[model samples]
Target: MEIVKNRFLKGVTVVLSALLVISLMGCGQKTDAKTTEAKTVSENVKRMPDEMTKVNLGLPSNKNMSYLPFYVALKKGNFQKHNLNVNLSVVQGGVLALRGLQSGDFQIISSLPESVITGASEGANVKLIGTLDIQSMYSIYVAKDIHDPKELKGKVAASMVPGNGTDIQLQYWLKKHGLEPNKDIRIINAGDNAERLQTLQQGQSAVTILSPPTDLKADELGYKRFLMRDELKTYNHNMIAASGDQIKNKPEVIYAFMAAEAEAVTFIKDKANRDEVIKIVMEQMEMKNADAEKSLDFVLPALADHGKINIEGIKWAIDMVKEAGVLKKEINLDKLLDERFYAK
Candidate 1:
């Protein structure tokens, strides 16, 4: 009777062990299924293309080194990396660029802070997002025979469209030297940098304001170049601006664009990447190595801190426009500038 009882307990133990083994196998199979599922999901995510936002960026001119960060961002694929399909359109002047932005022809614009301020004061719905150069990138280049600002009196000064940043700066500079713009020096719309340079060469104008490689070209031609920032200082020269609708409706796109611009500015400021940057400048602006190097040297220090806007600079620009009689009334800073996108 004892042997039979022992046999029954052994049989029960065998049955329980088999049941446990089956349950463990089932768990293993479930675990393997979950791991496979996770891997498949990850692979699909990797294969899917990122949704790119298309943006049109308008600029007064691309020939100047002031726009180098944008060029770098485009050439280095920084915009693409941030999922932006950016298209750059070069207009003749800041006013035209702003007009394009207002007309919905451009999603963003790089223009003078003064232009944005003036536009805002005039009921235009635009806001400054970021700045490229905190200091003025312009320099007054005179004919080879001219020595002083007074020498430019009764002579034509070549400029972009009236109310453009260059034209406004020229007027301010002339006024500082006791030379009224229209009376002492006649300012004319002589097209872009290259065309303005041609005007000087062809004897159509005696003085003009220019930036970068164009200034270098002017220097080579024996033109006397006077730096605008030497005295004017802290003017918001080139700024990134967008419409109010863009700021209100597409905040994420604006942030992405600023992120790409910040990255580009960082890449440009690095000394280790000097040669590559110079190469990019040469390719974009069609400049020689020496000219590119000189232009880069002049512009590198003037770039804003990671494309961030300068409040003091913007204020200075506003005052300048008011003094120049370009801006008639006071502008509200809160309405003119939207810092949320680039606050980081």
Candidate 2:
């Protein structure tokens, strides 16, 4: 009985020792994986220059994923590579951002070319240097109860702000669907997609236009997809504009800034950077990996190339603005766009 007991005890000790070794190995692997990920993130972040040129870039909304390339550039050191120190801020309204640009509060801003067109018409002396999003990700989403587009009649909707990109987008889509905006349904200037989503959830608005992460969330909530915007391919969305004064005084700065943006967009478009860019989308937009991946495939093909504005797309925006009552008379597109910077 003593011999049998000794053998059993020895077997039990060997099994426990083996289990301990396996556990330690697994923990080491997990540590290594985490360290590698951290290293990657650290490597991707660009360090600020000690004596960098200062440029403030304003954004329409902080949460909109349509402007991901700009964030990517900030993360990927494209700005630093181009010898520019871009300080990005939320200017709230596209027109306000443009106003800030003109007043010297902001050096550059990302907005729909229509806003820039309207500003040019209103005598703000701003010019679009580059187009960021050619095929807009903006799509109309309605509440679950309101299934049909016409059902949106007499219902309320939300936008980024009055006469901004999202508002114009909502109006344009409404007109396309045979419903007169403000005549058929009431559209109010709420806020960004994030804020708009909150208002929608609270039943303040039954319909709104949203971008990627917000759009993905709206889908999960079973909101009715009123207008996918896949048909409106001719019109471009976001553009980088500098005040006429900035364009005249510091054309080189505009060129460097635009070049960095172009590099960032190119980097995001590359298949080799797919994993990293998708990771960026997930982190920056606070989305799951699945949603990020889904958005990547949905939005990748729609990005503008070399940060150059499409002449045809600009024309489309001008036409839309004219119809929206933002522009009373025809303005020459040739004079509005500073194509020299983008051409380089």
lDDT: which candidate is best? 1
**Residue 284 error, candidate 2, Å:** 2.0
For each candidate, what TM-score against the reference? 0.81, 0.80
Per-residue lDDT over 96-122 for candidate 2, one digit per residue giving the tens place of the 0 to 100 score: 888888889888998887778888887
lDDT of 1: 0.85
- Which lDDT tens digits does candidate 1 get at residues 246-301? 87777768878888888888999999999999999999989889888998999888
Query: Which segments of candidate 2 are over 4 A away from where they belong?
Result: 1-51, 226-228
TM-score of 1: 0.81
Global local distance difference test of model 2? 0.80
- Against the reference, the lDDT scores of all candidates come to 0.85, 0.80
